[model samples]
Target: MNDVVGALAGAVGMSHVIHDAAAMVPYLTDWRGRYTGRAIAVVKPGNTRETADVVRICASARVPMVPQGGNTGLCGGATPLADGESVVISMARMNRIRAVDGANNALVAEAGCTLAAVQQAAEAASRLFPLSLASEGSCLVGGNISTNAGGVQVLRYGNMRELVLGVEVVLPDGRIWDGLRALRKDNTGYDLKQLFIGAEGTLGIVTAAALKLFPRPRSSATAWVAVPDPQAAVALLALLRDRCGERVNAFELVGRPALELVLRHIPAMRAPLAGAHDWHVLVEVADALDGAALDDMLERAIAGAIETGLAVDGAVASSLGQARALWSLRENISEAQKIEGVSIKHDISVPVSRIPEFLQRARAALTAMWPDVRIVAFGHIGDGNLHYNLSMPGAFDNAGFVARTGEVNRIVHDLVAALNGSISAEHGIGQLKRDENARYKSDVELDLMWTVKRALDPHGLMNPGKVV
Candidate 1:
C-alpha cells in the first residue's frame, strides 16, 4: 500500500498523512453511521513522539492499528475493518492541554483533549471534571478513556475508570507506556493504567492522560420528576439518596418513549410535566457550598417526594435557563433518536437493584417480540445505565426500522444477559458488539480478555478486529 502510505507519510507529515479517499472520509465512519472501512492511511499523530512513530511504522508493516478518538464511538469502536487491512490512529492531532495540577487535583490531558476540553481544563482550575457527557462536545479524552466512559456524572464522579489518573500507552511493540501517574495513591505492580484504561484499542495507543479533579459544584439543584413506573423511578432514586445526602448529582431516567422523542425532535422541547407520566426522573443536587442551601435543599427534597409517594410530579429548576431547559428534555434523546429513524441501540447495565427488574424484563422481552416495537427507554437511572432504544411503530419504515437490527439485538442482548446486564454499558464493544461480545463473554471472560490481548498486543497489531 504505497509502502504503507510512504511510511505513514514519512512518519506524520504529508500533512498528517490522510491519503485521500476523499481525505479518508472522516476517518472512515463511525459515530453510529455504523461502520465503514478501508484505510491505507489516516494517521494524524502530532505528539507522544508522533504517536510512537506511527506505532513503529505500523508495527513494521504487519499493518493493522485503529486507535481513533472523537469519532464519537457508539460501538463501532472507532470503526475500520471490512478488511482494508488498517491504519486509523487519528487522535485528532493530539490536541494538547498537557498539565493543570491545581494543587494536585490533577489534569495532564492530550489523547486529543475535548471531553469539552477536559471540562474546560477543570473549569480553569477552580476544579471539577466530573465526566458529564452526551458526547461532551464531541467525545475524546481518548474516547473517554477508551470507553470506560459512563456519564451523567456516573451518579457523581466515577467512571472514565474512576476519572483516570494516568496512562500514556503506545505499545503494540512500538513501546511507550509512560503510565502517566498523577498519583492519588498507587501500589504500583501491574496497575498498568488498568490495561490501557478500557482496552478498546485492543490494548495500546492511548497517548496521554492523568485526569481526576473535582470540587466545583458550589450549590446546584435541578429536578423534573413525574414517576409512577420503572418502580417509581427506583423509588425516586432511593428517595433522592435518602433526602439528598452525597448531594445526588444527577439521577436521570426519562421514559414515556424517551419523552416523546424529546418532544418530537427537540426544537423548543417542552413538557417538564403537565400530563404524560409513565416515568421521568432527571434529578440533580450538588454542593461544594457557595450559597449552600441549594434552593432549600431542592425544596425539602421535592416536598418529601410528593409526601412520600416518591414523586408523581415535580419541577424545580427556577433558572440556569430552567436548568438548561431541564437538561433539554434529557439531552435531546440522542438527537431525537437520530431524527426518528434507524434505532436499535442497547447500552445496557443493570443491578442498581436490577434496574426495576431490568425495565420489567426488557419491556417484556421487547414488547413480546416486536409488537409494533418502539421502546426508546432512557438512561443513567442513577447509574444502572440504559439507553435501551428500539423505535419503529408509528407505522414503520425507516428501512423497515433498520431491518430489525439483528432481531433487535437478539431480544435486547438476551434480556441483557438475564439481568447480569451489560452487553456494553458505556458503548465499547465496537464492530457493534464484536460478535455479540463473543456470545456474551466468558470462556473465562474471553480467556482473561485474551490474556490482556496477548500481553499488550503481542502482534495482534493494536486495534485489529477490536476489543478482544
Candidate 2:
C-alpha cells in the first residue's frame, strides 16, 4: 500500500495524493451523509494524462479504484467501500472549458467543470445548455453524465444522455479511449460513448465530454398552477403541450405536502395561490424568437384549462423576479425536506400518461400501511419522474418509519414494476439501490449487464460493489 501510494504521489504531486486519514474524510462520504467509506488515498489528477497515470499505478498494484466527481451523488455511488483497500480518484483539479464552437453548436468541457459553468459557457456564446437542476452550482459534468441526470428542462432539451455528444474515458485497464467526436450523426459502428454514460464509473472514468448546445430562448413565460389532484395535473400537462407545442420548457408537479415542507422550512416561501390546494405545477414556456407572444399564449391556454376544469387556480409570473420566485418554491423542496428530517426517498419514474395512476396508487398503498406517513411527492411530471419521499410529522415516529425502508420500498417498487417504471430515474444504482436494481432487472438484462461489466472491467476493480 505504501509503495502504491508513493507511485501515485509521483504521478501527481504529493499534495494531490491525499493519504492522510483526516484529510480524506470528505472524499470518503457521499452527499446524503448516509454512506461513509475508507480509502488508501484520494488522488486529484490535474488532467487526462495525470488521471490515466494514477489509474495505471493503481491497476499495477491491483488495488481497487473509485472514480468520484463533485461527490454530490445521493446514492453513495461516489463513496468508496469501508475496506480501505481502494484509491479514490477525485476529478476536482481537472476543471477546464476546452472549447466552445458556436457554429457547431457544441462545447467541450472537462469532467470537473460544474453544471452551472457549462450553462454559463453556452449562455456566453448566445446558446443554451438547458440541463437545469437544484445542485447545478455544485454538481460536476462527469457525475451528471455518469448518472444520465435529468432535470426540469428535460421537457424541452432532454437529459445528459441526449446532451452529451461524446466522452473521453480512462478505461479500467488505464487506457484512455478518446471518443470525443462532436458530430451529430455517426453510424459506422456501435455508439461506444453511450456505454460509459450512466454506467456509474464501473466501466471507466469519464475525464471530459463534447456536449450539445441549443439556441437561447429570448421570450419566456412562467406560471404556478393549482390542480385538484394528480389526475388533473397530468391532464393540464397534456393540454399545455397540445396548445403550446414544443415551447413548453418545464412542467414540474408539486404536491401539497411537498409545498408545505418548503413553506415551513425554507424561509420566506409563500403559496402561489390564495387557497390551499392538494396539488400544483410550475410551468415554463420559452422561444428563441425575441417578440414571441409566449406570455399571452400561456395565459390564454391556462385560462382555457381553468374553464375546462383542468386547473383550479393559477399565478403566472409577470416579471423576471416573479419567475425566479416561482422557481425557488419548486427548487427548495429537497433542502426543506433535509431540514425537516430524514425520510425514505425514492426517485422513481413511469410513463407521462401513467404518472397520475402511479402517484395515486403509490400514496394509497403507502398510507394504508403507515397510516400517519407523510408523503412528500414532487418532480418533473413532464418527464414522469417523481421524488416521492415518505416520513412522519415527528422525529420520534419518523425514526421507526425509516427503519422500515425495505418494507416501504417493496410496496413502492412493486407498484413501479407493475406500471413498467424504473426504480431509479436519474440517480444511479450506487450502493443504496444496487440490490434493488438487481431485484427488479430481468435475468436476461442482468446477464447482459454483467457481460459488459466483465468485458470492460475484467478484474472487477473499477468502482467495485456498484451498479452491476
Candidate 3:
C-alpha cells in the first residue's frame, strides 16, 4: 500500500495524494451521511493521462479502486469500504471544458466539470444542456454519466444517457478507451459508451464525455396547479401534453406533507395556492421562438383542465422571478426534508399510467402499518419517478423509525415490483440499494449483470461491493 501510494504521488503531484485520515473525511463520506468509509489514500489526478497512470499503479498492485466525482452521490457508490484497503480516485482536479462544437450541437467536458459549468458552456454557444438537478451547482458531469442521472427536464430532454454523445474512459487495466466522438449517428459496431454510463464505475472510470446540446428555449411558462388527487395530476399531465404537445418541459408532483415541510423549513417559502390542497404539481412549457404564446397556451390549458375537473386551482407565473420562486418550492423539497430529520427515502418509478394507483396503494399500506408515519412524496411525475420518503414527526421516534428502513423498503419496493416498476429509477444501485436490487432482480437478470461485470472487470477491482 505504501509503494502504491508513492507511485500515485509520483504520477500526480504529492499534493494531490492524501493519505491522512483527517483530511480524507470529506471524500470518505456520502452526501446523505449514511455511509463513512476508509481508504489507503484519496488521489486527485489532473487529466486523463495522469488518471490512467494512477490506475496502472493500483492495478499492478492488485488494489481495489473507487472512482469518485464531486462525492455528491446519495447512494454510497462513491464511498470506499471500511476495510481501509482501497484507493479513492477523486476526479475533482480534472475539471475542464475541452471544446464546444456549435455546429454539431455538442460539447466535450472533463469528468470533474460541474453540471452548472457545462450548462453555462452550452449557453455561451447559444445552445442548451437540459439536465437540471437541484445539486447541479456541486455535482460533476462524470458522476452524472456514471449514474445516468435524471432530473425535472427528463420529461422532454431525457436522462444523461440520452444526452451523452460519447465518452472517454480508463479501463480497469489502465488502458484509456477514447470513444469521445460527438456524432449523432454512428452505427458500425457495439455501443460501448453505454456500458459505463450507469455502471457506477464497476467496469471503468469515465474521464470525460461528449454531451448533446439543444436549441435554447426563448420562451417558457411555469404554473403551480392544485389537483384533487394523484389521479387528477396524472390526468392533468396527459391533458397538457395533448394541448401543448412536446413543449411541456417539466411536470413535478408534490404531496401536501412535502410542501408543508418546505414552508416550515425553507426560508421565505409559502404555498402557491390560498387553500390547503392535498396535492399539487409544478408544470412548465418551453419553446425556441420568442413570444411563442406559451403563457397563453398554458393558461388556456389550465383553465380547461379546471373546467373539466382535472385541476382545482392554478397559478401561472407571470414573471421570470415568479417562475423561479415556484420552481424553488419543488427543488427545495429534499433540503427541507433533510433539515426536518433523517428519513427512509425510496427513489422508485412505475409506468406513467400506474403512478396514481401506486401512490394510493403505497399510502394506504404504509398508514395501516404505522398510522403516525409521515409520508413525504414528490418527484418527476411526468416520468413516473417518485421520491417516496417516510419519517416520524417526533425526533425521539424518528431515529427508531429510520432503523426500520428495511421494513419500510420492503413495503414500498414490493408494491413498486407489483406495479411493474423499478426499485431505483435514476439513482444507481450503490451500496445502499445493492441487497434490495438483488432481492428484486431475477436470477437470470442477475446472472447477466455478473457476466458483464466479470467480462469488464474480471478481478473485481473496480468499485468492489457495488452494483453487482
Candidate 4:
C-alpha cells in the first residue's frame, strides 16, 4: 500500500496527494450529509495527463477509484465506502476553459469548471448555454454530465444529455478516449459518448466535454399563477404550449405546503399573488428575437385561462429583477426545508397526463398511514418530475419521522411502479438508491446493465457499489 501511495504521490505532486485524515474530511462526505465515508487518500490531479497517470497507478495496483467533481451530488455517488481503502481523485485543479468556437456553437470546457463559468463563456461569445440549476455557482460540469442533470430550463432546452455533443473520458484502465468532436452530424458508427455521460463515473472519468450552444433568448416573460388544482395547471400548460409554441421554457409547480415553507422560513420572500391557493405555477416564455411582445403573449394566455376558469389569478414580472425575485420563491424551497428539519425526499416522475392521479393516490395512501404527516410537494411539472418530501407533524420530531423511511419508500415506490413511473427521475441511481433501483429493474434490464458494466470495467474497480 505504501508503494502504491508513493507511486500516486510521485505521479501528481506529493502536496496534491492528500493522506491526512483531517485534510481529507471534506471530500469524504456528500453535500446532503446523509453519507460519510473514508478514503486512503484524496488526490488532486492538475490536468488531463496527471489524471490519466493517477488512474494508471490505481489500475495497476488493483485499487478502486472514485472520480469526484465539486462534491455537490445529492446521492452518495461521489462518497467512498467506509472501508477506507479506496483513493478519491478530486477534479478541482483541472478547472480550465480549453476553447470557445462561436461558429460551431460549441465550447470545450474542462470537467472541473463550474456550470456558471461555462454559461458565462457562452454568453461572452453571444451564445447561450441553457442548463441552469440552483447549484450552478458551485457544481462542476463533470458531475452534471455524470448525473445528466435536469433543471428549470429542461422543459424546453432538454437535459444535460441533449445539451452535450461529445465527451473526453479516461477508461477504467487509464486509456484516454478523445471523443470531443464539435460537429453535430458525422454519421458515426456508434455513439460511444452516451455511455459515460450518466454512468456516475462507474465506467470511467469524464475529463472534458464539447457542449452544445444556442442563440441567446432576447425576450422573456415570467409569471406566477394560482390554479384551482393540478388538473387545471396541466391544462394550462397544454394551452400555453399550444398558443405560444416552444417559447414556454419553464413551467414549475409549487404546492401550497411547499410555498408556505419558503414564506415562513425565508426572510424577505413574498408571495407573488394576492391570495393563497392550493396550487401555483411559475411559468416563463422566452424568444430569440428582441421586442417580440412575449409579455403581451404571456398576459393574454393567462387572461384567457382565467376567463375559462383554468386559472384564478396571476402576476407577471415587468422587469428582470422582478422575474428573479419571483424565481426565488420556487428555488428557495429546498434550502428552507433544510433549515426546518430532516425529511425523506423523493425525486420521482410519472407521465405528464397521470400527474394528477399519481398525486391524489400518493397523498391518500400516505395520509392514511400517518394522518398528521406533513407533505411538501413541488418541482418541474412540465417534465412531470416532483420533489415530493415528507416531514413529521407538529407534534413529532425529525428523528421519529425519518425512522419511517423504509416504509415510506416502499409505499411511494410501489405506487410509482403501478403508474409506470421511474423511481429516480433527474438524480441518477447512486449509492443511496442502488439497492432500491435493483428491486424495480426488470431482470433483462439488470442483466444488460451488468453486462455493459463488466465489459467496460471487469474488475469492478471504478466507483464501486454505484449504479449497476
Compare the candidates by lDDT and give the number of the best one. 3
| Cα distance off (Å), candidate 2, residue 229 | 1.0
Candidate 1 residues 1-468, lDDT tens each? 898788778877888888778879888888668688888878888898888888888888788888888888887887788788888888887888888988889888888878998888789889988888877887788888887888787887778998888888888888787888899889857687887777778878888889889778876878788878788678778877887788888888877987887788888888987987888788888887644378777778788878878787888887788988998788878988887767778888887778888778767877787567778788887879888877776644546766768877887788778878778878778777789889888899899889878876777888888766
Q: List the residue pairs that clash in candidate 2.
A: none
lDDT by residue (375-448, candidate 4, tens digit) is: 89999999989889998855366587689798999999899998999988888888988999999999999998
Q: Candidate 2, 40: how far from true, in Å? A: 0.7
TM-score of each: 0.38, 0.99, 0.99, 0.98
Model 3, residue 126: distance off in Å is: 0.4
Count clashing residue pairs per candidate.
Answer: 1, 0, 0, 0
All models, RMSD in angstroms: 17.5, 0.9, 0.9, 1.2
lDDT of 1 at 135: 73
| lDDT value for model 2 | 0.93
lDDT for each of the candidates?
0.82, 0.93, 0.95, 0.91
Model 3, span 272-349: residue lDDT tens: 899899999999999964644888899999999999999999999999999999999999999999899899999999
Candidate 4: worst-modelled 10 consecutive residues by lDDT: 392-401
